[model samples]
Target: MMSITFSGWEAVKDRKNLSANEEPKKGHCYMMYHGTHLQNAKTIISRGFQPSKDGLLGPGVYVSRNIEKAKCYPLTVDKKDKVVFKLQVRVGKVKKINCDNHPMQKTWHQNGFDCAWVPPNSSISSIRSGREEDCVWDPSRISIVDVACCVDPATRKELRRLIQHNNRSGGECDLCHEESDCNPHPVQSCWQCGKTICAFQQKHHCKH
Candidate 1:
């Protein structure tokens, strides 16, 4: 279970381009950002800005087996930006795919020679704000390991307030019979329909 942390938009671009095969240089290992819901804290936490997926990249995260030898360049967009969040990933869970002859490549990229494929169930672990450069282990051929962390108290309070205010009355969840509680803490809100949903029931409410 190797852990690598990257900050700034450059890392973000590298992650996306590596997944898409648009990167000029190909390495044995790559890093990806799977936490999309943390977009609000992207710049603040060094989560990297989301790049447009209009190119050869598919809609999933991809990584190389040999990320230690991977070389990163300076930011082309924002050079002076400081490192924000240290994205920690447990690479032991990654599933390998033959980038050369994977069937999914046909749909992912028009030119099959480019781009990579991400296996199902790939996820992220913890993320922090700091400058920690250490390579703990290699994720190339390791099995999955369990890792968990608690949410911050301030974030929890804020979520609770947001849920209560957005839910209001008559905003019962379509999936679950339970209505918004007096101390509701919604994880997702539908601005189009003005509905608030808890984290557990977000999938049933939104299509995305």
Candidate 2:
């Protein structure tokens, strides 16, 4: 298994089991993050992530190795309303698609790769943040570790208390306890006007 740990200050402070440095190896488990609104985070905890029908990489669950990048997600949601999902991803075979229009951008999975990676600061014009991103083709390969709620329960009526996870070593989604399904698309904020744009409709966003 290929395991690489980005033990930024957050990880060291929160997850001690995560080490500082490691090389990427195929089939290794990695700690990644996914950002969403409070409601969506709750739903994801109840269920598991569903692969998107289409995205920048097409038909995968978008995630980031950098928690800072993850925190910027669901771009339209206010920072306080957002929550980041810490995930343990068992990235199988990996493909690097560093530029737009790469021959394998959307077909990496079909070509036997389990994940498509966009390196940080690559020449992808659509990426305003220049942060590392990943698209895992199989939803089952990803598991939620815990949820970091950015919103304060004292301020939000709906968020009475934050989601808590005492054990970080074991990962299990609520899906195992019940039966349910969801088809959720990725969303991002337009760099210019802050409009929430669907990943598929990115080109049409901020057309002023």
Candidate 3:
């Protein structure tokens, strides 16, 4: 129910400097619009909403944002008494999800999480890993473990059951196999080498 309303969309028709009439900027493309739900609603737009064919705004570098439509912005008033509705504010393209960036070093990704290299003087190693000679992030050095990745061993084990549910083992293991000797075992016994393996396994441990 809290909203700021604008009036006189008709008056902006003659205001050539207003954005709705302009073609928008080219580089670092961004656009903003303002208006109201009233009879004489007014709007001001900054750049193209999104790249398009007939509305061909930019073919080069452009801003990227989740809110691509003008109607999605929530209307709110600032402390300075300025009525503003901001939607789809795009700084740039979506390079990665779960990403973090620091000013001084290289950017990398781990377990689908983005990582930014640390500045030379800004990093200190964690006591847990105890490798202070190496440069590391000082912010508790969060290590992301991918629970849904196929490459990481732990994640592959976690996801194996989901992806290969119908495979040889139905994600169960026999306690009998844990012991040295057991005849009838629920664990998967390799058909080739006849070695009992855990039901929940990434692969049958066949060393041959």
Q: Which candidate gets the maximum TM-score versus the true structure?
A: 2
For each candidate in turn, the TM-score is 0.23, 0.64, 0.14
What is candidate 3's lDDT per residue for 1-208, written digit by digit as tens? 2432222112211223313222222112222322122211111121212221211111211111111222221235222222122222222211221112332223222222222211122223321221111111121121111112122354335433432332223222343222211112234445656665544333443566
Each candidate's lDDT (Cα)?
0.30, 0.67, 0.24
lDDT: which is higher, 1 or 2?
2
The alpha-carbon deviation from the true structure for residue 67 of candidate 1, after best TM-score superposition, in angstroms, is 19
lDDT of model 3 at position 27: 15
Ranking by lDDT: 2, 1, 3
Candidate 3 differs from the real structure by a C-alpha RMSD in angstroms, to one decimal, of: 27.6
What CA root-mean-square deviation does each model show from the true structure? Answer: 18.0, 19.0, 27.6
Rank candidates, TM-score, best first.
Answer: 2, 1, 3
Candidate 3: segments with Cα more than 4 A from true spot: 1-80, 86-93, 97-99, 102-208
In candidate 1, clashing pairs total 5
